[model samples]
Target: MEQHTVVLYGKPGCGPCVAVKAALERAGIEYVYVDVTTSPEGLEHVRELGYQHTPVIETSDDHWTDFRPDKLAALAKGLGS
Candidate 1:
């Protein structure tokens, strides 16, 4: 499997963010967590992406907002190959 980087930009106390983190962990996917509340750059990057919410997930080939199990499944499947 080719190594891919996943970055999760989220703030504290976000329910979806917590779910996304748990889903990624359950999928055995390693990811870097950026607290947007503390990281100015991360907040700027998420805003630049046109998202006004937390739990912004960015993979090597795609990016999305909110807790999406289907997307996480696809990411796992892609990484498995």
Candidate 2:
């Protein structure tokens, strides 16, 4: 299977974002981290996705807000190849 790119949009000093980052790290999943606090484009992208929260996760097939371990785990297992 082709490997999918994983992207995480977050801001500094956000608890949920921190937790999500930790979970992804523990799951051994490689991902691109975007700091919306510093990047206007990143913040715009998060808003365009219809989210008002930090820790927005985006995969080729899905996108969601906050920390979702189950989804993260599924992503790690299914797309970590």
Off by over 4 Å in 1: 1-3
Residue 33 CA error for candidate 2 (Å)? 0.7
- Candidate 1 structure lDDT: 0.91
Residue lDDT tens for model 1, 27-79: 99889999999999999999998999989999878899999989999998887
Q: Tell me, by lDDT, which candidate is best.
A: 1
Name the lDDT value of residue 21 in candidate 2: 89
For 45-68, candidate 2 gives per-residue lDDT tens digits of 999999998989998888999888
lDDT of each: 0.91, 0.87
Each prediction's TM-score versus the true structure: 0.93, 0.90
lDDT of 2: 0.87
